[model samples]
Target: MPIIVNLDVLLAKRNIKSKELAKIINITEANLSILKSGKAKAIRFSTLEAICEALSCQPSDILEYVKEKE
Candidate 1:
């Protein structure tokens, strides 16, 4: 996948644990795990907004795009 999820990096930078973040974002750890692992197919805008607010970051901080080498 070209889209890379940098959620774990941001969490570590903020010294926040996944469980705590999940609670703050009102999401389950299992779901957050899926997102952090970049395995989630899609994320709702509301969920993204909540995560950004909780982490004090922008969406770009959590998500990135890298072109795959052909």
Candidate 2:
């Protein structure tokens, strides 16, 4: 997966716990964990909006694309 989820880094930078973020975003911890771990196949725009709103950041701040080494 070339797409990286920077949720954990953002959380750490903001001094927010997963539980707190999940609660704010109205998502379960398990689901949040999946997103953070880059195991989620997709994410909803509304969910992304909520995350950005809560974290005071943008989609680019949470997601990054890296080229895979061949």
Candidate 3:
């Protein structure tokens, strides 16, 4: 996938655990784990907003686009 999920890295840099973030964001730990593992196919705007709010970060902090070389 071109879009890489960097949630784990940001969480680590911020010294926050997955369960802590999930609790603060009101999301299930399993769902957060899926996202952290980059196995999520899509994310809701509300969920994204909650994550950003809870982590004190922006969407760009969690999501990155990598262009493939042809």
Candidate 4:
């Protein structure tokens, strides 16, 4: 996927567990894992807001665009 999820990096930097972030973001641990693993196809704005709020970070910190190699 050209879109990369940098959530794990941020989570580690903040010393937060996936389950803890899931609870704070009001999402299931599975869903959080999906997002964290870059398996999610899409993310809602509300969900993004919740994640940002819980992580004290911006959307850019979690989502990044990577150029695909041709």
Q: Put down candidate 4 lDDT per residue, 1-70, tens digits, no spaces.
A: 8999999999999999999999887889999999989999999999999989988999999999999999
lDDT of each: 0.98, 0.98, 0.94, 0.94
Cα displacement (Å) at residue 25, model 3: 0.8
lDDT string, candidate 2, 1-70, tens digits: 8999999999999999999999999999999999999999999999999999999999999999999999
* Model 1 deviation from native, Cα RMSD in Å: 0.4
Each candidate's number of clashing pairs is 0, 0, 0, 0
On TM-score, the leading prediction is 1
**Model 3 over residues 1-70: C-alpha lDDT tens digits?**
8899999999999999998999998989999999999999999999999999988989999999999878
Per-residue lDDT for 1-70 in model 1, tens only? 9999999999999999999999999999999999999999999999999999998999999999999999
Report residue 39 deviation for candidate 3 (angstroms): 0.5
Candidate 4 Cα deviation (angstroms), residue 50: 0.6
Q: Give the TM-score of candidate 3.
A: 0.95
For model 3, what is the alpha-carbon lDDT of residue 11? 92
lDDT of 1 at 2: 99
Model 1's alpha-carbon lDDT is 0.98
Clashing pairs in 3: none
